[model samples]
Target chain A: MNWYRKLSIKQKQVVWAWTFLALPVLFYVVIRFYPTFGSVLLSFQDWNLLGSKTWIGLENYEKLVADPVFWKVFNNTFIYLLLGTPVSLLISFIIAYHLDKVSFLHATIRAMYFIPFMTSAVAMAWLWRWFYQPVPVGLFNNFLASIGISQLPFLKSTFSALPSVLAPAIWAGLGFQIIIFMAGLRAIPQSYYEAAQIDGVGPWTVLREITIPLLKPTLVFLVVFSSIGFLRIFDQVFNMTTNDPGGPLNSTKPLVLMIYDTAFNAFDMGYAAAQTVVLFTILLLVSLLQLYVMRERT
Target chain B: MKSWKKTIIGATAGAVMALSAGFAQAVEIEYWQYFYEARVTAIDTLIEKFEAENPDITVKHTTFPYADYRTKVAAAIPSGQGPDVVQLFYGWLNDYVEAKLITPLPTDAFPPAMIEKEFFPMVQAMKKDGAYMALPTAVRSLALFYNTRLFEEAGIDGPPKTLDELVEIAKKLTKKDAAGNITQVGITTGMNAQDHHWWREVLTRQFGGDPYKDDYKTVNYNDEAGAAALKWYSELETLHEVTQAGFMDEGQAAFKAGRAGMHIDGSFRIGALKSTRGLKWGVAELPAGPDGMKSNYSSYWVNGITSKATGEKKAAALKFLAFVTSDEAMQIWLDTVGELPAKPSAALTDANKADPVFGPFINGLGYAKTTIFANESGQRQVIMDAMQRILLEDQSPADAVAVAAEAEQKILNEYYK
Candidate 1:
């Protein structure tokens, strides 16, 4: 008890700071940091979930580099990011811009758009899959057939599968992005828009000169956020094309799904860890690249 | 009044003591399975009976979704928290054996001679390292399920007997609108997953090629015959225009909805198919290949004790397993789940064989082959992809098979190594 009173004020402050940080620091070490290091170490080893782990010294990585499926999944993960981010951002921004001016049932309309984001990804994937089925069973095909148009294969054809999967993914993410955009729009001073109106400036000109410039922060944040979301996409692709996951011929397969299949289905933990390390590197690089690209001009 | 109070106190103490004693003496063993309505109900009833019979032991039941079951088991068993007794697909036997996750049955309890005499030939799947690692209550084999009304409407007199006849009948049965959209499908094949299973287990055999060789260590389906089978399976979609890969939610949905004429499925689906309102369906033996070679698949889900269980828990699990695979449980499974009994004596009885809906599957027991593929799901995906390349990407079947064989061979090579 007497030892407690012997500490200096600076020491006491240090002790308190560490005491407050201790729980989170311990948590990060145990839950987050431990697994990260373990996976990195495992990347260089060979272990099937059941057997003893062996030190293969980069053999798993060599295999990954040589694997054709890994390359396809790598290309797919990027396509998801490149296509999903810009398309969804444009859509949500457009919806939020128009929705901000509407007075009637504003909350209801906003809630309707946001509901999909809150809904289960598995359910959403299955629903979208149902909509993509052939003529007699699928909604899209039936509607097309009724309108005297040819039934287009949404999920069956390899050329159409990646984009078809991207549509549902983009839809599922719009609600949160729209809410952020709306908040950004709301924060902009109304007087700027009023002045622009008094000067006889049109909506498009005001949007271009003032709104877009002011909303750049929100835009940049969402672009990075949505890009990561798309890059790590698994549930939609897994659930929709579950009969043969990763899409037909792996057209819709992403990196994370490949990691899951490798780890769980194949039980190749070391190989799976290597793939996960690769995914982690890609995510880090992409996020950093986006942040650098969107840095302030001044 | 004092006497009455003493009596009540004494009785309360005794009751509390009895309850605690019961809790202390009871042993609990958990049983795990994938979610299936009929399978669950049948097992629940059997578990109730088991608990009643063995007063000192309690059994807890757990079920995960079908797609996640194997993964959950693989993760759980290694963590020391898996179920004491587990129901696993027979295809996983090799993986489990290699991983040392499950123990072989004691010979005293399940003697090899007894097993050979009692169970069907597929029981060979349970033997690893010259001992039985698992035992099953029910077994299933794929059979041809055709919509009777659809066949009659299409002017087909009988189910096709050969692969070429199937193509002809499927072409006749397919119904298309003026816009060239298929309204009714003849069969479910092409890139669909079921197509791959049928191809690997049935068509590959018919085409005189095997999926794997040398104790499942070599990929044997990369040759001309494999290419011919894959090409034939895809012809249902491309050549005949009968059904495309995306025709229904899957093959079974098409048959249930009366939109498909012929579907290849296991006897496990009979209970559900029988209840489909206003649908007239009939089961036939799977058609032979071009060479008139007959082959079919027998897939079984067996219950085995995990290696994590030991001592008293292991003993209790064995008792549970014995009860589950006994004649009574087999009868219960046959009556309720619409699956063939794994026990040869139980299944080959005249009364059971006379059953029209289940008869074909039971008869298939004679020739059905149970594949010991280590990762059935992964291998299925490989074949499905090969089919997709042929149908959607216009890849030649020979090239597609070569590619699939290369990928599948990689998996086998790793396993064997």
Candidate 2:
């Protein structure tokens, strides 16, 4: 009360503004920061969800380095990220651009594209599993047969399984990226397009010069989020592959799946946590690297 | 002197009060089980009957789904919060017993002589250290489930009994289109293989190789017999060209849709098959291996009264266990669940023998064995993972077996030494 009385009107307003901001900061600390810190601590110990923990310094980290399975799963996860993210972004950006052009159908087409993101991952994975079934009677295989193409091993082949999983992952993820890009595109001042038109720019040149540059922030965000999603990929691979984790010779296994297997199946929680820390570091470094690259480009 | 007399009186009064309170309170026994909706209903009915009979004691029932039950039990027991009576898979017996987490019942409490006379020798031999840690309630085994409609279309008579005959039937049953793309599989393998340890165990046994030594101290499956077993398994996809890799679920669907002839699965699949209308099917034992060994690994759902239980509560739990293992309860279970009764007196009945769906199970039980539970979880995982790698990845059996043996030995040395 004394401080407020002593302060000028502007200083009082600044204090009120900070007080309002403090609430959200407190909320984040309680809900997010605390749990994140706790998980970091947990990563150093051997714990089952129900049991007492045993502390084992960096033994877990050491073991993770030697685990062949971890390398294979990590490779699969990177493959998923590499194959899924760009394809998704490209498709989404194109669709968003075209939908923006269509004045009347923009809303409906946007909604249609967003429907996959709205659908549950479990349900989508189940549907995709049925479609990827390996026999002639299977949905996709039947379609392939009608066109006289031999049935491809969509999930079972070690060479193709990661890409096969990526298809559904990309499909499920496209809607979000599309909506994000659409929002970003809508925010682009129409005056820029008009200026480009005055310069006699073609459609492709306008897209490359103006649209891509303007949407850089959104693209960077999508890349970061999608990279995180791909690195921790678990549910679809687990459900669709009958909990094989690494299906048909460690093809579809990802880092998260590896963590789950180590902790639950092998009862090596310390090692699992070590792997999780490695994943977190990788994610952090990648996100930072992306932000730096994007900022430099700008 | 007066103060001393007062102190002694106070102590006596306190002791008397405690005794009276103890007598007034009824003993409570905790029972844990894993049951689906129907089994839960049946068990609840049985509990009602048991409680009505035992008026002085109360039995608290806690249940979980099959998938979570094992982990729940493992966690609960060590925390001193485990139930006084528990149901478990027989495979978990050694692990629990080795930990001394379960109390072994006295041989006199069971009708031991009668059990010896009636039950299969293999069933009784599962016990260790001269004490039975668990009593089997229901049993299941692997069998060849064949689609009758597909067999008729292929002009085959019936299921084969030998490997050569199986191969011959498989070749005929396989349907390839003009372009040589496989339209239908003759057999399916590796479905549920990750969780279903029985399949690998049965195959290992049929190859005339025991995966674990009798003492449970060493693994013995790296020999020629083990390699032959694995090779034969791989040949289903690699050599015979009857089944394709990763076609297990598809083959099951096809079999259900009347497109495939044979699929190997456990007796638990009866309900799913029965639900598929207009599909003619039959069950037979898995084909014999080169050594004419027909032994297939089987598993049992078991029940046991805990050591923590005592007095009237113990009696009540025992009564319920006895009833579930009794002829009447076995009949209800068999009729409702289509599971083979573990008790000889119940399983050997005319009704069970006459039922086609359950008959193969009973026959298979004669040749059934179980993987040796050596009280080491790591060893089990290592061996099972190796088998999966071989079957799924087409790793040479020799290499797989060698790795598995080495891993098993390492685990044994670390944990059991």
Candidate 3:
């Protein structure tokens, strides 16, 4: 106790601060960081869950590189990210922009948009699956038939399956993105828009010069966040294609689904770990790239 | 009055403590299976009987949804947890053995000769290195399920006996709208469903081709006969236009909706079909090929003692397993689950063979073949992809068969080698 008293005030404050930080730091190490490093190590070994792991350095990686299905899945993951992020961003922005002006039943309409985000992904995917089914059973197909238009094979064709799957995914995410955009829009001071109006600038010019420029930080954050979400997509695809997961010639199969199939279905833990490592690297690179590109420049 | 009330509470607590002390000495083991209502009820009844016979032993039953059951077993076993006796699909037995998740049944308790003499020959697929790794309580075989109302509406007397007649009947039963869209299909075809098994075990054989060579380690369905089978199956959609793929989402769903004339499904479907209101369906033997060849696919869900079971738990698990596979349990499963009994003694009775709904499925067992799967889902995916290529991409039947064969061979080599 005397020794603690002898310490300087700064040192005492440092000791108190670390005492509070100790628990969460320890938690992050044990719960998060430890398994991450373990998975990285397992990527170089050959294990089938129950069997003893044998070191087969880089072999799983080699096989992954050569596997055509892995490449196709990698392409699909990027497609989800590229297509889902921008379309969701634009649609949500448009809705939030228009919705900000509407006062009648405003809260109720906003709540309606947010409901899908709260609903279960599995339920939403199944609902969308029902909508996409062929005529006499499906909603979309029946409507088309009623209108005298040829029925579209929404999920049956390789060309249409990925987009059909992406549609619901983008829609499910709109609620959350709209909420964020509205929050961002609300944060922008009305004085700037009033100034633009005083200058007699058009609405488009005001949006381009004031609103969008001010909304840059929010856009960057959402871009990174939603990119990661799309990259790691699993539930919607898994549930929609439950009968033939990643089917129609693997058109809708993403990297995460491949990892799941390899790990649980095939019981090839080593290969799955290798795939996980690749996914982790891809996620890290994509996030970093987006951040770097969107970094503030003076 | 307060003291009297306290005394009553104290006495109740004491009695509970004593009962728990008795339970503490009993060996407890868990059994897990995928949740199906009838199977769950059947197992609960068996558990009640097993406990009554052995009051010193206690058993706990667990079930998960079919989608997550295998994953739960795989994760739990290596951690020395979950299910002393676990139920697994017979196709997954090889994976379990290779992963060391299950232990071989003791030959002393389950002699190989007795198993061969009593159980159907198809059960031999469970044998590895002269030891039985698992035993099933019930077995399943494929049969043609025809909607009686649809047949009557089409002016057909009965189900077709040959493949050519099947096509004729299907074409007759089909209905179309003014826009050339199919309103009612002659039959349902989806490779994602039982059609993969039908093509591999029945059609391929009937077309004079073996699906696999060398105990299913090599893909041999790349030949002319295999291509012919593929062509015929796909032509049901392309040329005949009697059936369509993905109609009403699934083949069974279409059949159940009374829009399909015929559906090929396993005996396990009988229980569900029976409960579907207004569905007038009858079972028949699968249509024969042009050469009069008949074939069927047999499969089962088997119970095995996990490696986690040892000593007292192992003994209890074995006792429970033996009871579940006994003749009495088989009868209960057949009654509740509508699956055929695993053993000839229980399944070959006159009543089972003569019953209208069960007779066709029972007759199929005599000519059934079980494929020793290296990777069942992967192999199924190969066939499904082939079907999709033909239906969607205009790929030739020969090319699709060759691609599927090569893809399946790679999976087989990955496992066996």
Candidate 4:
């Protein structure tokens, strides 16, 4: 107590600031940083879930490099990020742009879009899986058959399976992206659009010159966010192909699903950790690259 | 009269005190299994009986969804937090053993000679390092489940006895629409389902090819006979056109919806099928191959004591394990779960052999084989991929089998090495 009374005001404020900051710092160190480093360490070891871990430096990474399935999974993850981020961004922006002009039943319409985002991923995936089944059982196939069109093997064919899985994933994320885009549109000053209208500029010019430029920050955030989401996709693919997860020659499998299979089904924890490290690295580089490209350039 | 009343009150008090003491000293053991309705009910009943018998021990039964069950066990066992006695698929024994997740049952409680004499020969798959790691209450074998109404409508008086006859009857039973789409398939086909097991254990063997070369440590099903079997199986969809893959989404679903004339499934399907109103179904042995060879695939879920169990917990777990595999429990399991008892003594009674629905499955036990899988999920994926390659990629059956053998061999080598 005597020592505290002798302390300077600056030192006392520093102590108070640290007292508040300590918990979260401790949390990030223990919960986040510890496992991050531990997984990196584990990548150089050999362990089943139950047995003792033995140091087998670089073997897991070597095996991963030589593995054909790993390469396929790596390719699938990139496809999801590249395809899912752009397509979803464009669709959601189009919806939000047009939707902002409408006034009747606006909240209800927004709610409808948001409902899918709120629904359980497992349930949505299952519902989509049912829709992809053959005629007499599937909704899409039945509709196609009724229209005298041949059945499309949406999920059964190896070539189309990955894109088919991606469709629903994109659709499910559309609502969230649309809401974010709408908020960005709302944040733009009315004066700029009013001035553009006064100048008698076309809607296309206004959209290109004013709306999109103003929405760039929202676009950047969503691009990075959805890219990470698509890269780490698991539940949708896992549930959609429950009987043969990532089936049709592993076409629809993503990196996280492979990590899950290695960790649990194969009980190869060290190898799974190695895969996790790879995924972490990919996420980091992808985010960093996106930030650099999308950074404000004024 | 006063002294007699005092004595009676004193005796009552003493008994109450003893009962409370017993409750205080009770050792609780946890049991874990995948959630299946009938299995959960059966295990619940067994737990109640076991608890009643031993007042000093309580058994806690926990179940996870079938999809998450393996993940739960894998995550929980290493932390010494999950189950004392856990139920695992028979095919997972090698994995469980390699991981040291389960301890072998005590020989004094379960002697080797007695197990060999009483249990079916296939239960020997649970043995490792001179001890039995697990014991099963019920066993399952695949059999033909034919819709009787469809059979009668097609004018087939009985099930086929040979492979050729099966295809002929299936063609006759098929119904098609004007658009050339099949409305009712003669048989259901999906390698993603039980067909993988059917192919590896039954069809391959019937066609004179052994699936494995050395106690399931080597992949040996890439031969001419294996290709021949693969051709026959794939031709059912590509050539015969009596059945199609992905019809009505799943084979069992199609059969349950009465759109499939015949389905091949384990005896476990019996309980569910029996409850479907207005559906007439009959069970039969799987048809023999061209050489009159017969084979069937048998599998089971076995209960084993986890390695974490020791001293008091071990004693309680062993007692619970023994109780579940006893004759009474086997009877209860068979009645509730529609699976055959693990032991011939409990399963091969006159009453069970005479039952129309269960008889064929029981008879299949005589020729049943359990494939010792090195990596069950990985190997299943390989076969499924091979089938898809033939059906979708237009690859030859011979090539598909060769590729599958290589992939499966890789899995085997990874596990065994």
Candidate 5:
């Protein structure tokens, strides 16, 4: 009691700040920190989820390097990020830009676009799978056939498979991204557009110079957010190719799916943990790289 | 004096009734299984019957969806908690035994000699180190399930018995639109993406070559027979042009719609085919490979007792197991589940043998072989990937098989180590 009374004002503020921070701090330690470090430790050990873990050190990493499937899946993960993010981002921005200017049935139209994002990913993946099927079966193929178009092997061919799987994923994400872009568009001052009009600058010019420059923060946030989502993509690939997940010679298999297969299907926990660590490193590097590249100049 | 004597007798009788009630509190043992409509109903029915038969032993049943069944069981069993009697796929039998998660049924309980004498040859897969760790009530084997109406439309008399005849029938049955688009396929060869089982388990055997040898440690499919089998499978799409990748939609779409002339699938699909209205289908033994050998893949999901079950709980679990594997239970399982009885005596009845639909699957089990997959799911995917190369990417069957063999060999080596 005497020591508590002896504390200065600065000391009291420090203690108060920590008192408020206690729960979240404890949560981070238990829920986040523990598993993370445990996984890292586990990457260096062999475990079958049923046996005692043995320290095998670097062997898991060595095997991963030699594993051909890992390389294929690594490329697939990047393809999801490289292709999915930009394509979805562009589509969302276009919709949002046009949508912001609209007055009639704006809410309804916005809701329509947002519905896909809110729908369950697994259901969306399966629905798109049906859409990608060939003639007399798929809606897309039937429509093509009715109009005298060759049936596209959307989900079957290795060349077209990733994009086919990616299409629904991009579509599913558009609603959320569009909503974000719309919010950002709405936040911009009307005065800038008015001034640009007075200057007789064209709409495209204003869009490139003012609207985009002002929306940098939102763009950065969304880019980082969607990039991570694409990087960790599993459900879409898993459900769409449920019959042959990551198939057509593993053209659609991603890092997360590979990690899952190694852990559960193969019961190679050590190898899976190694893949997880690689995924973590990739996520970290990609985010950092994006942040650095997109940094606002001083 | 007479009234006093009567009261004493009544009190003694009452005391005896109380003592009996105390002893009959019921020993409850829980059973866990994967959720399929038929499976759930069958288990519930068995529980009702078993409970009625053993009034003192109460059996509680719980189920999870198929996808999560193995993971749920694996996680729960290690904590000394979970069902006393659990259902496991044969692929997982080795792992469970190795981990000591399941107790091998006491030799005294089901003598080793009795096992060989009574059960089908496939039941040997249930054993580890000459001890029966788990036993299945029902077993399944792959068979060629064809749409009978489609065959009639194609002007085919009956199911083809050999690979050459199948190709001839496929060419005849196929239909095309004006633009060269395949509107209806003659045969949806189960050789695309996920349909690798037909190629690996059944065809590999019928082609007169084994998939693995030296205790599943080495890949033995690098020879002439394996390549020939794979080449024939690839040619179905590449050269034959009768069955395309899109024909099946990679999800049994073509078969269910009756657009496919022939489908090679397991007996497990019988319920679905039968339930689909406006569809007439029949099951036949898979067409023989070049060597003229008939082979099929047989896999079983067995009920295993956990090591944690002990004393009275162990006794109750054993009672449930015995009841479920009994001839009566096997008959009920056969009638309800559309799977063959595991016991040879129970399955080989004249009525069952002569039945048109179920006959092929039952008879195919004579030469059927269960997978020795250490990681069955993983190994299946590896082989499937190999099939995809030949079917989709135009890779040579020899190269594809070799690559797949190497990958599978690695998995096997890792497991044994």
Candidate 6:
């Protein structure tokens, strides 16, 4: 007790700093880490909401591996992540780059691009559902008919359903990614561009060499977040497909939707928990790999 | 800070005084339901009448959309924030009953003679352990909805009365382009939950096989009759090609646009269809199976007063439940919502007899039956999921039937054990 009281004022200051820093860390552990650990533990037990949980060990994991529907949903999720991420990034980057070029109306153009992000996912999904309707009264079908094309199966066909759902996700996501890219573009001092100009660097050359390299961190962050978002896709599949998750022959089924179906619809909490663990592990590993690749490049 | 504290104290005293006055004077009951627009308007009108009759009690009504009602109730009830009374779907009764989340109505609360006289026997089958789990307010049954214009264009005289005739007429009504891509379908095979149940029931009944045995311990969906029924359903899409694969919503849109011939759905769809202009539509009984068996599946909404509620709250809730199920209140519900009344006295009224839109539903009550065998919600979902896989994914009927039977049996064993 005497030693504690005799400590230096600098020591007390360090202790106070540590306490302030620990508050948020403690909160993260309690709220996020605790529930995640509980979910993983739940994966090993057979639990209905009201009943006593029985220990089943790896049985749920085994069942998940054998379940055909699980594999179907996993494939669908990867397809979405694979197709959705790069396309969204490219489109958003281009829009951000163009908006950056227009200094006068940049703020207005940015707000216009960001409005979709501000809209609720359910509202957007409903609007898109009406847009992709198969009848002539449907917006997309009417457009097709106007161009002398027969009505296409936008949301009704197995082949088109995944892409149709992806369209809205891309549309809603572009605003945030565009803002990030714009910030990254701003961070690159004009001196580099002026230097490149003196050296006779073309627009494409400047983009390839200086702009993209400088924006690597933002690109990496966007890719990781967007991939995670696409992997856990649920709302669009649920709302746009008439509450039929994985509609059109399980073509739009994603990992999170499958988890919900298993736990809530099928009441197989243990199996659903197992699926969640698997999804969490996959995302963790993929993100780690991405981080390593980015580090290596740097 | 001192002034703020004083204000808080003053507000707290005022709230306590208001609460004491409310409790001492009249019962305020919280009632939850899923209704919008016309149904909401009808319910609001009924509430005004109810409040007039029971001047001492005030009912606060909350509304949710039909889709989110189950989840909202489940979360609310567990947290003890649920309303004193809730409108429940018959399918949801088993889960809530098993969880003991609902209170059983006192036997004397509802007149037994009135129940026997007014309600269909099918609605009574929802009771568990000799206790009526819910009081059904409205009943709906599956019927064949035909596009009158399309039927006329196809030269079909009227709706089919037999399975073979339905297929034949459906085939004639289907329109295809030169490349053989189906532009318009004849029927949307699996549009709603009742449609799936209707198919299963008609097939099981026709095959002379019980889908679920009397004990409810076994599911016989893989039996010969069940298999035969499923095979025939598959033939509609695969062999005869009257129905298109992966085009259920498309088919519904087509039917709505006067391109398709028939839609198998519940009576609830009539309201939405009626809202459309210049569309001639008619409802008829589902075609009988080849074995001449007519199996009509019915679904309904039930209102149950909570077992947890007590004193004035309980009394008020029961009063509201009785009011909603009463002939007068049911008349308002039926007239506005297009749903058939669960009460016999209400169903037999002139309003019901004269309404052409609801005649098929009322008449179909004669052959009405619920899926008594697979009453468990889990088993029902499993069967439907399997059915979706088979119908949508082009899975082998035998394989789908086996998977469904196995899943159903597993659920039964789990629960019974």
Candidate 2: the clashing residue pairs are none
User: Comparing 1 and 4 by lDDT, which wins?
Assistant: 4
For model 3, the stretches where C-alpha displacement exceeds 4 angstroms are A1-9, B1-17
DockQ of each: 0.67, 0.16, 0.63, 0.58, 0.49, 0.20
**Which digits, one per residue and each the tens of the lDDT, describe model 6 over residues B196-288?**
676566666776767776556778768777767777777887898887633535445556777678888777777778887888999888888
Record all residue pairs in model 1 with backbone atoms less than 3 Å apart, i.e. clashing: none
Worst 10 residues of 5 chain A by lDDT: A241-250
lDDT tens readout by residue for model 3, B1-417: 999999999999999999899877799999999999888988999999999998878889999998888888878988989999999999887777887889999999999999999999999989989999999999999999999998998899999999999999999988887778897899899888899999999999889999888988989999988999999999999999999887888889999999999999999889889989999999999999889999999999999999999998899999999999999999899888899999989999999999999889989999999988877888899999999999889999999999999999999898887
Alpha-carbon DockQ of candidate 2: 0.16
State how far residue A276 of model 2 sits from its true place (Å). Answer: 2.1
> Per-residue CA lDDT of candidate 1, range B159-240, in tens?
8888888889888889888888999888876444455667887888788888778877788988888988888887778888
The residue ranges of model 1 lying beyond 4 angstroms of the native Cα positions read: A1-23, A194-205, B1-12, B190-192
Model 4: CA > 4 A from native? A1-17, B1-20, B98-100
Candidate 5 overall Cα lDDT vs. reference? 0.85
Candidates sorted on lDDT, descending: 3, 4, 1, 5, 6, 2
TM-score of 5: 0.93
Alpha carbon lDDT of each predicted model: 0.87, 0.74, 0.92, 0.91, 0.85, 0.79
Task: Predict model 2's lDDT versus the native.
Answer: 0.74
Q: What would the per-residue lDDT of candidate 4 be over residues B195-232, giving only the tens digit for each residue?
A: 99889988898899998888888888999889999999
Score chain B of candidate 5 by TM-score: 0.91
lDDT, candidate 2, at A72? 83
Candidate 3 C-alpha lDDT tens digits along A1-298: 8989998999999999999999999999999999999999999998877678999999999999999999999999999999999999999999999999899999999999999999999999999999999877899988998888989998888999999999999999999999999999999999999998899999999889889988989999999999999999999999899888998899999999999999877878999999999999999999999999999865
Candidate 3 C-alpha RMSD relative to the actual structure: 2.0
Candidates 2 and 6: which is better by TM-score? Answer: 6
Per lDDT, the best of the predicted structures is: 3
Which lDDT tens digits does candidate 2 get at residues B306-388? Answer: 65666766776676677677777766766666667787788877877777778878888877866655433455556555656
Over A215-278, each residue of candidate 5 has an lDDT whose tens digit, in order, gives 9989998999999999999999999987777877789999999998888777788889999999
